[model samples]
Target chain A: MAEFKKADSMLEWFDQRLGVVNFVKVMMTEYWIPKNINFLWAMGVLLTVLFTFLVVSGIFLLMYYKPDVNMAFDSVNYTIMQEVAYGWLFRHIHAVGASVVFLVIYIHMFTGIYYGSYKKGREMIWVSGMLLFMLFSAEGFSGYMLPWGQMSYWAAYVITEIFGGIPVIGDELVVWIRGNFYVSDSTLTRFFMLHVLLIPLAIIGAIVFHFYALRFPHVNNEEGEFFDFDEEAKKYLAGNKKESKVVPFWPVFLSKDFFVLGFFMLFFFYLVFFHYNFAMDPVNFDKADGLKTPAHIYPEWYFLWSYEVLRGFFFEIAGVSGKDLGLMAFGFANAIFLVLPWLDRSPMVKPANQRPYFKYWFWFLMADLIVLTVYGKLPPTGANAWVGFASSMTFLALFIALPFITKAEAKKVGGK
Target chain B: MKEFKILAVIAALVGITYYGIEPYAHHIMHPEVAPADFSFKTLKNVDTTLAGNAENGKVLVEANCIACHAIDKAGYPAIMPNADAAASYGVVPPDLSSSGRIYDKNYLANFIFDPVSAMHLEGKYTPESGKQFPMPAYNWMSPQEIMDIVAYLQSVTPKVTEGKETNKATFEAACGRCHDMKYAGIQATTPKDNLKAYMGATPPDLSQYIKSRGEHYLHSFVNDPQVLLHGTSMPRVGLTEKAQEEVIAYMEEIGDSKKAERESLGIWVMLYTFVFAILAYLWKRKIWSEVH
Candidate 1:
């Protein structure tokens, strides 16, 4: 009660009793962030806000969406679009929000990579973030099924069929995932549960851990130097008038975060209200049909790089099934990203501009990813497959050769 | 102040861009109407009250339809060779087995009165092109006689061996003459190029028609093709109400069989998410307010 001596109002009285005021001050208001980071830093906060929007809008859609094969198409087209009040708005937001969320996350990830944010003590943060990315993929795939459109049905079939390429229990595994001999009622029901409940809960848990890991490391800056928060606090306590390199989370970073969020929202709301089908496929308007597969079957754009890698390796290696190997290659592509911290043996954790060789390699990887994404969208035939193969090889080589390449570059440049 | 101004400009640009392009994008995404020249009213006003016995309908189908159509599941060895039929009429007549299930009875009766008018192909083709009007007008037949034929077709349901039934037999009997079934792994007996030359447009494979058009649209279109899209070579395959329902059921079985289960579980999912969202909102507000 003595702590309440400075309490000035009724709200302060409740804060004194709850101690939530202290918790907030410690976690947010008093927290120090580097002032040198750019707008890329805002993507993490934007992703969180977008994820919230997705979940809320998704809930509204789930209210009217039918996951059954027969009614699923009609429910979305007739019931949601034509019947429910403002259902079109929610549906468009959820659909388009998915692509925008992935765009933000990709930028956030590239920002981490470009600045070596995954180095040293922040490995756990990187791991948690990668896990969240994996969960996001799972969430996206499962949500794609809820529509039960032509694309949804065929994509599920093709992806599940990939499991059947395994050697011993492949057929059984496919059946296990599908919950039946084919992608049917049981499959749709199971995927619905996973999309709406299971994967989202997992994403929330992963996000909490990601933030927790992030808290210890603070944030990586352009200089790649450790920030001392205690020294900054001491300066503030002593009534120093000089400008500090470290800024408070509130007002400083908060204003910038809000500004960026508002800008992003303007664009997002435009897409939702005006160009809602910007990234959607027209063929998906039709209902699911197992007997008739669409000419081209592909996952969302975020997954295209890995999907292209899988398609590139569509040939038998020795006696192993090419399909199985392709699936393995795809999984390995994603797994490599999770272990990037250990893969690079360089002692210095400088920004890309300071590390010339590292910068070139990073840009090469980005180019490779872009090539794969484009190739994945095109028909996998003749020259396209060969190009995809070359890009896939380059992608693997970049990760595998990173340590040696960086080590050699360090020796040539003389140690920093 | 600089940051504020930049943000204000960005906001203004977004608003301007949104308002400027919104109407055009809307027009593209959802066109105001179907193309002008391809318009025809649905047979919503056609009378469908006439009822006919399946047994009598069977006799009528044997007397009139058997010459051009195979009414049974075993559709091969049709009375006229498909090539000769295609050469003579510009489009080979479809089999009649599944017509009852895939069309509306009212549309079936109206289409029977004038085949060329029902399909809007009165002068779309000429004899010099070897693409004359395909189906002969059967307006002389009474509405009850057509209804009987439809009833008979409806009675010939595909045998369901298990929970699922294949539409192979139904599709082959009805759509095999003009359209190929190659996508579904069934080979076409007629030469595709000749059929295409005769019909003008290659009849699309019907294997995925159920998935594409849906049951409601399929019913209307199948009853009278011209009503949905003008100047198509597809003749109205006049079928009874019961027959159309059966065909739609067959299509559904082959296509979206799990639709019922998918729709039924949506409500619970919505309720759960709603409760979770409210709790999440409260938690976010509480946590976020600490910084404020």
Candidate 2:
């Protein structure tokens, strides 16, 4: 027994945390990760990885590109067609990565929302994630304008110029933004700085906060249960009375995460390496001309819903043009999205616990988003007026009505 | 095992965050100019004749008119009231979307070469109209390039609508930061009480000012306002002589509907930061629990 204890003592000395050498053991021993984590729980981790990929690849491309209306297009082309080896792949990855990051974040957020991940102890994570999303969108917009392509210039012109429809100071603000009359070198440089440095810093800080807050409360399972660790199981492993119910990281959670990570990595590699040619071509392959507007000036696909909303308002509305109304509605929609976590303060975190009314909202919100996507891609004809009206209503319903619905449902579920 | 899972997740997150930060930083570090579709070869579809290629025309405009006449929907220049909107001698910059609608090629050519003819400084649009455009002449623009500009403007269309308020508020918010006060409403010369009533921080009403001020004053004011009005708030509006003439000729549309929003977020940022800090402090100290 004494000899067995001596060997155990050596193993115990090796099982250290933080400063100790048995770091892996210590992590396996003390950390309290839930056993029944689902695929949704892995989304946050995946998004973090995707964000890193976007930043690393974006830096490599920026080294050679210029941000002037005159030279920005050529510089991007030169990098892709001439200078950088497989530069096209890098650009595609960065572009797709941006969309993917948004995609992942949206899923993660929905998961959080569906599960009541913002209640009580997890509020900080939800808030931090919201901040990250806002920064990400800004970064995406600023970067989208960099290629100085037709789409890039038009997107910048359309979005930036949207501010000109304001009650006053429209033109001056527009000029101030462009740093000249239109999207010139100054505008490109300014946007470049913003996209790369300022927004990224904010994203990094927000992510740090997100994880820091998450660490204290860990992952909330789908069943909406407070963590209950088995101390007797812990003590049995520790050779003391405090037995722990902890599962091994390698065979259980690690295996699941690794499998998912591998599948995503394979898809990403295929996307970057094989099927890479895409439509960021206007700027890289063509020169920007203010007079020659494209037949369709659509935003990147992820921004389609809001873009559709903006385009739909080109008709007469409450003493305003469709365009002005579109702009206002689009802004309002985005503003709501930024504040969603706070807006949804439900106590339920799982499908079973959710009230039927909230469940209906959840499913329909997805349908509305799909409708907006379709609306964004299509031209607004007289025939589409009803479609526009319906799309707008759906967006408002999802944005404004659902929060109250969720709150009411939460009250009923809690028997309050 | 649970501890190990946590550590693995943390490591994975750190690795990914590093990857995301760099390229995203790079892409944003220098905004790449947006790409343009150079379908100049396909201009046949649009049925617009450009003396130069549309791409070249855009570059030419950038070099010439973009300094003053904003072609992009976003960069519309500040329009002062012309004699039409002026009290006695008021002048406003007209929207140039239909410059082709308003002027023929010969008139545009002469206007580009000499502002006096177009402004009718020597006479009027017709003696019956009794109105004159105080357009400064452009000795700098070549007649061919002037024709090209005409061609470009002919291709342009106006998309302005009713709710798009082009008011004093909009002008000050959008164009005021750069142009300063070369235009009228932007000038600090207006009395505070009048300005507050007109629309706080309103752009000056330039209709009478432009008509009475004439081409020479408009030209010199835009070129170097310090020479005319000492310590003027207007920055040197960097425009070529041709652009100055076109802009002066076009300051015609000013109304309450066409205004911009003042996007000063300094106050909001300060306010939010204060709120967040308070929240953070309360959260850290557990003050909220004690209250509850």
The most accurate candidate by TM-score is 1
- Model 1 achieves a DockQ score of 0.04
lDDT of 1: 0.70
- How close to the true structure is residue A50 of candidate 1, measured as C-alpha lDDT? 96
lDDT for each residue of candidate 1 in B176-195, tens digit (9 for 90 to 100): 56765433455555667777
lDDT of 1 by residue, A1-416 (tens): 35347778877877878877888877786777776666667788899999999999999998999888778876886577546776766787788899778877877898788788998888998999999999998888888887788888888888788788777999999999999999999999999999999999999999999988978777888678776767865664464514455656765566667656765776676666555543455557656777667766777767778888888886777997767668788878979999988886775678776786888898798778877876776677888888988998898889889998888767867866
- Candidate 1 residue A91 Cα shift, in angstroms, is 0.7
Task: Please give me the DockQ of candidate 2 compared with the native complex.
Answer: 0.01
lDDT for each residue of candidate 2 in B1-292, tens digit (9 for 90 to 100): 7636644754564344323333332243223432221221211211223363445445555666644443434355533323222322222233454454334445454555655433323432336756443344556655556666666665664433323243333333223333323224455333334334332234444432333344455656654454454544343333344444444553323210111111133334345545544544444334212212
Best by lDDT: 1
Worst 10 residues of 2 chain A by lDDT: A276-285
Model 2 per-residue lDDT tens digits across residues A320-391: 887778778888887775566567656666652355577787767766766676556555666665686678
Docking class of 2: incorrect
The C-alpha stretches of model 1 lying farther than 4 A from their native spots are A1-8, A236-242, A413-415, B1-134, B137-292
Q: List DockQ for all candidates.
A: 0.04, 0.01
TM-score of 2: 0.53
